[model samples]
Target chain A: MSLAGTGPRRDGPARGRPRSEAVERAIVEGVMKLLEDGVPLAELSIERIARTAGVGKAAIYRRWTGKEQLFVDVMRAAEPPDPELPGTSMRDDLVVLLESLRLRGLAGRTSAILHNVRAQMKSSPRLWTAYHDTVIQPRRRVGLDVLRRGRDNGELRADVDLELLNDMVVGPVLVRTVLRPDAELPADLAERVVDTLLQGLRPS
Target chain B: MSLAGTGPRRDGPARGRPRSEAVERAIVEGVMKLLEDGVPLAELSIERIARTAGVGKAAIYRRWTGKEQLFVDVMRAAEPPDPELPGTSMRDDLVVLLESLRLRGLAGRTSAILHNVRAQMKSSPRLWTAYHDTVIQPRRRVGLDVLRRGRDNGELRADVDLELLNDMVVGPVLVRTVLRPDAELPADLAERVVDTLLQGLRPS
Candidate 1:
């Protein structure tokens, strides 16, 4: 909160040299810890983050414009690399992508932060846009690419909208996460979800 | 936020008879109004609800156990009745159901409350369970019945998991609502969603 003010000249650090990578990493790590601890967004202040990160408030201000900006950076940094799945078939690709998401995307701090973001997005549009652009869209692009490959290879029907197809394949995992945070996602969840979608997309 | 204390004897009201429907209506109305006006859940106190509803604190306490219970009642009251769509075919039934959900479920105060609940569920498991049981499950049952009918008619392949089938059809709308809150769901969205699912489930 209040990482930077909304002044007219709300650019990068007002008058300081760029901080080192070490300092930036510390700040991002601090944010991740707080989110994992299930700290409500309202209570996550810049001052507290500075203290936790062992950096000065001026250092945090020098790096990002505000809490939302900082959150975007943390999410981007924390995002796991796209899985290196073999392009064996559409079904195999989707299963690997989704299982990676469940194991890495929804694991530990990332899962906690995502839950917090879903809850807070409606109330904070600016933050939502930043998070979506920085974190969600990039990951989504990977999913889209997979579907596009399937369509191009004649593994999937050409007529279906790729965006809608993307949602169909991936949406259930997200919905399940939101509804039952404590429940274990079945080991076969990704396989089952993909099979259902692939059946819909198979060329006639 | 403190609707009721977590005391040992935290049963229903300690004394007095059940409140009248008029008083109950006022309180529920107050909760709806505040949610529509964008009051964050953390700031939504029972005292404020009492003031907005023009009812005494004792009146609210007399009926429900806490804010969570009152919220469940409001959601139950606000839910639109299931659409009486013609059971023309599986595709038609699904389109009508999804459209009704978009029009009624994601509109106005109900939409706002849903966004709030998604955010608050982690912090308030008891409230989440109450809301899901009272509001979400009943609507879900209607969707399940539609799938059951489709299977019985031999329109869909019998081997598909009915629960997963329901998620495949309905999950996209919920995901879209969360990701892009302001975007209009296309008129053809439901038809397209159903078509995709049905293709996968078509009898061999």
Candidate 2:
């Protein structure tokens, strides 16, 4: 159940004229690498990352309150900004959008970060809200945009609730991937999802 | 966060001569009681249940392999047998069908068992599958049957894949209930859900 995170705490602050930006980048990259490789946070020690990153552990702690905070950034690192795409065709747009989710889910780095996010969300509502603001909202807006576009394009009948559609696109895959790791992904799941959604969303 | 059946074990055997059927029934009821109360498993130990059920710990262990197994049974206990209602009308039938789910999710006993069920699904596939067979499949059949009825009745368009409709019906509520434990039941959530599904399931 334990997944890797940024790592353990360091006691001292960085005592130099200036900390190198390269070191900061290396710390994040090193943590991401460890997590992707299935390193458990229990074993993802700061000492291990320092050795890997060639950066002092003390410098890592100087910049962050804890491993969780650093991992929050790690989770937000490469996520797509929006859930939908604006384009000529709604179906084609959604196909690309959902495919992005599929690609991200298939990636070891993204899945690990998502798992960590779920774990953190359980204990920290404040962190959850913050992550929602910094991490989840932009993605939500994209989904909203796609539905709005779909209606305008006549691809979808009007009278559809865009907000509800936005929830549908993200909620299922997110739950299936993050909550049920072993859930089967049909080869045409994205197409089927969009098709089914459009069926409901079509204006009467 | 804790919406489903993660609270206390309910499947273990109760002690006494010939494993009194009456007392075992009482034990199951006791488990449901604790769940409705929002009691965590950590606090709702076997000792408390035994005392509450007036049974011995040996009895509880004899029935279930452990606390987890007990809770699994307690959970499966609440899932209703699939309804055999046969009719062509999807709307009337669905109203009957979804009411069962709402009763379960909104009711104290059922919701508690579900809370524990969700927490454990990711941890143990074996238990989860068993729980599904014992719990979910029964509930699932209700939706599947409704779709069949919808197709037979002129109300639903022909050529609709009932399986997808099945997912459409149950998946969203589950997503809402699990992701946001405090999610308000929108005044029209049920009607909207049925309407939306009908719109999708309708023939082109």
Candidate 3:
């Protein structure tokens, strides 16, 4: 795995300046294109990605250790970047986190590419674990941290289970996105989910 | 689609006793056996299922219209039956509905058969629609009816969106079951979720 801030390592013969950003974009987009066209992940190879990207296998190798690393990069490139928390309040931060989820769900509709790619990824244990570690866990940690802060600051009831709370807060958005694909994701979905949950279902 | 109550049609020459109960069980179990052994749903045919169940093709056709109808029955037979909602209270009824979902998630771990079979079903639009109509929609309708009754009886806030509330109440269970398969489904999960939501997150 490449270090986040250290930049791409220029190890192979292609080492002069850093790799062109255009080349990187092209490779990532090419993988996305193949996935969009219904190419199953199991069928994708470094050779095939290089062919589609119009680059040599060496070029792909220069950037990624292998298919798994490249796939992690592909998912990162595809998702909406992680939310920038406002530090204003827990409620505000949660809305930003959920809004990002809503956008990903909307974005996933393009060729339903993410949905297809994820399904294929889940079929292989190694690939799915890679994705869960790199892409899923960190984002989840962010949500948990926010909830922890909320509980400590007395914004949330101390007795509440943070893990369960995290699920309750995130679950509605996921239900719409993953399970109920036909359901509309209104623009105010994030706010509605947050406020409704905070206010409790019982009338005051 | 065989009508729920109208027993098997006895039009076929071989049918004298409305299809033996033992044979019906065998056919459904046979389909499940194939799925459990990792047979792709797309590859299953009536003849293949008949061969596995040790019944003739005629026996299957006499029972089901075709693959889609048979698949629906398979899903139905596999799922824990819909809860008999306790007419006690809205909260109690919601818990019953969610407990059923919890059981399903646990049941699904066996061979991960439901997860795999559902994934395959979604790939085929026609088949998925049949499933959505027969299995998914009815279950959703039951939840909605319970919510409606709750609102009417003043057990729920009058202004609540029943649809959204349904998703909110059901979402956590689905998250634990479907999204975060690693999460524990504790014995009191349904009660905990309901009470927490009713109490809200805001500190009293």
Candidate 4:
């Protein structure tokens, strides 16, 4: 757990990269531990994280620009790995993407980690913006790309607004995960959301 | 503005009702002013609010159960009045509901009032739950009722889960108002969301 001296050294290219990764992991894990322990984000100073991780402050600063950037990494580390889209069809790809979100919702650790961080981040504009730019927007872009491709391939209505469509498609997952945490996220949630949406809401 | 002596009195039945209403308005507006002035919720005490409103603490306690309940009234006082459903059709009613949300988004003061309150409320489960129970849940019930009515009238697919459908219908608005504040809430947003979902995302 003491990652002090294992940090990357300028002179030691032979093993520096692996040591650097270790230092990075230690720093990120240190943040996760603090959040999981109910430490308020406002009180989580870099010095505290460094002490907890047993690493030098320089080790953390070398990896991230600021607290916001560091928290982004903590979020990324705690998250389930992003789904690898099947690329076979837009519907299939969308299900995979949404399934990843559903899995994230099911993971107790991710929710625990986010519960405090998300609460504080909203009050801090800088932190909220950084999270949106780095974490949310990139994921949004992936969905948009899938939708755009689907439109081109005649799988989607060409006249549709992809941006709005993307929001609609992803809206339910976000609502359940963020707004109504108590709601059941059943195993077939991804399929239910996608299929229900595709079939439309109107009576035939 | 000095509502100290105007509070309801047991002996004065004829004038007591109006005086009580004035006292209530004074207390609610006082809280709004403090919040608008950037007072953190943690620092907002009943004593401080009474002092700010030129009313006795007994006056506030007589009306509200606690700080949580008082804040609920503050939210109510600050909000645009809830949309009156047209009851012409489910689609029209939904459009009116969402249009009200869009207007709330467009209103600078409502956003300003909610900005700090929403951020801090998330950290305080008691306050967040109070607001949800008092404000969010009531609005959600309205939407659910409409969806249920739609299903009964054969305007909605019988297979749809009303709870999830309600979320889907309101999800886009919440995203723009709460999550992505910068997203444009166009005038036609409600119609677009309803029509798009009704038509489905697939190619016709």
Best by TM-score: 3
In candidate 4 chain A, what residue range of length 10 has the lowest lDDT sum? A1-10
lDDT of 1 by residue, A1-204 (tens): 112232112465444324456677888889888877888776889999999999999878876767778876665555565579788977788899888766753563356575565566536788777766765676788889988888888888778788888887777777666544554567888998898776663234
Winning candidate number (lDDT): 3
Q: What TM-score does each model's chain B reach against the true chain B?
A: 0.71, 0.62, 0.88, 0.88
Best by DockQ: 3
Model 4 chain B: ten consecutive residues of lowest lDDT: B1-10
DockQ, per model, reads 0.28, 0.26, 0.75, 0.68
- Candidate 4 at residue B126, lDDT? 90
Give me the runs in candidate 3 sitting further than 4 Å from their true place.
Answer: A1-23, A33-40, A51-56, B1-20, B51-56, B111-116
lDDT value, candidate 4, whole model: 0.80
TM-score of chain A of 2: 0.63
lDDT of 4 by residue, A1-204 (tens): 211222223443344667788877888889889888988888999999999999999777766667877876776677777889999999999999989987887774357676667667777888888777877887899999999999999999889888898888888887888778888788988888888878898888
Question: CA shift at A76, candidate 2, in angstroms?
Answer: 3.7
Error of 2 at B59 (Å): 5.8
Candidate 1 residues lying further than 4 Å off, grouped into runs, are A1-27, A30-69, A77-79, A104-124, A182-184, A201-204, B1-67, B109-125, B201-204
For candidate 2, the lDDT comes to: 0.61
